[model samples]
Target: MGKYEKKLKEMVFRLGYFTRNWRQIVHLALATEHFGVNNRTYSPDFSLFGKRGPGKFLGIPERIRMMRARAFMGFIPLKDAVRLFPGYAARHGYLKGEENSGD
Candidate 1:
């Protein structure tokens, strides 16, 4: 993104943090990165960025459990999810705004 775009994106993200309630914050966190994933922490049953939600691994229907995992990850409040799970986020090209927040 351009310098101005990055600034605008961050501005939007911070705005979300204020208006979103506690429950919404939790939903954003889970619906996006969930717990996030690393090479050491991932398996067939767990994908941080995929069509199937976590419940899908436990016999739940995909249609009922689907979440915009990657989309929600873009919201500013959850930006740190990329930093917290840099391995998978980096591998999946989720470094747009948080390019340098490596752990």
Candidate 2:
């Protein structure tokens, strides 16, 4: 596996530990060159660059679960899926102010 893949796998495992759901980590198909959070660049596996709803992409369901897990772990407000929507949408090509209106 490549570096990012390894890192992502590691992060997923770490997230599993934190999120307690290693058996079901939804990985992003693409690798992010770099992502920023709080003005710091991070390589979050499922960056909120193209997120909108609960069924937009792969790992979204798992992300939702992890976000909820965050609440029990601590006050990680950023872990909320709604807050990550912008970045997730951006990654998946569903930029804010341009959401798809299909059914």
Candidate 3:
């Protein structure tokens, strides 16, 4: 891989997290006290296509697969999302506990 890709992966490794199974997902769903809501995880692999997709020359399914890879699910607290993304969750109105979030 190129140096930039290596560094990007490292940064993601440092800041990103993924849950291994449904139990954890459920825990995140039922355990959060903020608005009695389920917080979800943010996966980079799932968002690979958010900014741009593989060149249009590629087949549509391939592009879809690139976007729908099996690497983007887990539960991140909305609070963590606010911290990780910095104002994005609030602006997007995902903050069910806005008053509790102190944002």
Model 2 CA lDDT for position 7? 55
Q: 1-103 in candidate 3: lDDT tens per residue?
A: 9968855764564345434333333323333223212223433233222222434334445543332222222234544444544344555555555532232
lDDT per residue (tens digit) for residues 15-77 in model 2: 555454222232222212233322234554545543545355666556565545543354444
Residue by residue across 1-103, what tens digits does model 1's lDDT show? 8988866766665466435433433333343333323322223453444335655345333322232244335643356555334545665677755555332
Candidate 3 TM-score, C-alpha based? 0.22
Order of candidate numbers by TM-score, starting with the best: 1, 2, 3
Output the number of the lDDT-best candidate: 1
Runs of candidate 2 with Cα error greater than 4 angstroms are 1-33, 38-56, 75-103
Query: What TM-score would every model get versus the actual structure?
Result: 0.24, 0.24, 0.22
Model 3 lDDT, residue 56, Cα: 31
Count of steric clashes across candidates, in order: 0, 14, 2
lDDT of each: 0.45, 0.43, 0.39
Looking at model 2, residue 94 earns an lDDT score of 42
What does candidate 2 score on TM? 0.24
